[model samples]
Target: MASKQHRLTGTQSAIYLIISITLNALGNGITVSLNLGSALWTASAVNLSHLVGGDLKLLLMLIGFIAIIVNMILLGGIQWRRAINNLVFMIPFSILVGYSATMFNQWHLDNLPLVLRIVLDLFGIVMIATAVSIYQRVNILLHPLDDFMQIIRFKFFKGNAPIAMWVSFIPPVTMSLIAIFISHRIYAINIGTIFSLLFQGSLVGWADRHVFKTLKHQGLDKLMTAKHQ
Candidate 1:
């Protein structure tokens, strides 16, 4: 029974990871398509890409690498193994996000009616919230920026999730603002960015309590705890 449970857990974890990645990618695509802007970390990456003349995916990867290094430094030592594991996830996820954004942008979604674009942006935000909720529940190695934020939250905020989340927004938002000033154009910070920052945490919390609660009741929550013995 334990063996079977372990296998089931592994499968579920894989599924959850895939779902989170796909949803995140789609959400990114929506933001790109609308030319509105992305979530905080992404906004910084996009802006850097604009200034540095590289693919957004590469820029995101660079940012993620720097974040990981900073995180390790703050923790007082480097963990090479963990850093490699984080890169393993971050690289593929960045590629998918970039590809999804490119494909969606090619559709010229920004040309849609204003109301429709707003609706789609809202949908994207919801998708991102859902993705984050699932990603947290799955308990896998997180993306680099998320891992960095978690460390910061625990280390400084006494593990206060809300406070950590708000604090985590500062660096990325600051970077985005700096990039905007340097470029004299918005690569990825706008009204949508404001809405996302204000509401994404609430939405994720709701999903954790309601959506994930329902999943738990359905026995899916076992997957969250089903690691190898």
Candidate 2:
């Protein structure tokens, strides 16, 4: 009887997991698309500033590169053993985003109305949400950002995933909020870019716990074992 109950509970959890992953994947796809769009938007905004500095662009580029490198180091340090081979996908995936951003930049957006701008941002948010979901499913390597988040969470809360995730996200969202006032100057907008990130981060955790759990019980992890190795 106990074994039967256990199986039943597992089955229910599996169903919930599948649903979560499906939702998360859809959200992630939207998020990635929006991210590329937003990058172009930000670059355009920066260009709007008449203050020109060749060195500033280079500095920003260098800083971005360092950030990525630092994130990787943090990920390796925290999820070292959890790291899997499939994490390499992030490289090509990043290139795709870069290409998409370049293409988006070539298109003239200055004349685009506020409504359209907001719409584009919405689409980007969807892509980000979808990407988060997909990451939960992949479970290959926690993104460096996610790793940094988990480490901080471990340090403070030890085993509390929610707190850790929140800590990881707060800084960026705060920065974006500041940028909005300094750069966009759009007022009375509560959601902005931060909403999508928070939504996606939450979805990732939910799916990681629920969706991935289902995959493991369904023996799907075995199919990816050789690939991950």
lDDT of 1 at 159: 41
What tens digits encode model 2's per-residue C-alpha lDDT throughout 14-56? Answer: 4543444344334333333333333222333233332232353
Each model's TM-score?
0.77, 0.46
Cα deviation at 86, candidate 2, in Å, is 9.5
Q: Model 2 off-target regions past 4 Å?
A: 1-90, 105-113, 150-163, 173-191, 205-229
The Cα RMSD in angstroms, rounded to one decimal, for candidate 2 relative to the true structure is 9.2
The clash tally of candidate 2 reads 17
Candidate 1 vs. true structure, TM-score: 0.77
The segments of candidate 1 whose C-alpha lies over 4 angstroms from its true place after superposition are: 1-8, 49-55, 74-76, 154-160, 214-229
Top-TM-score candidate index = 1
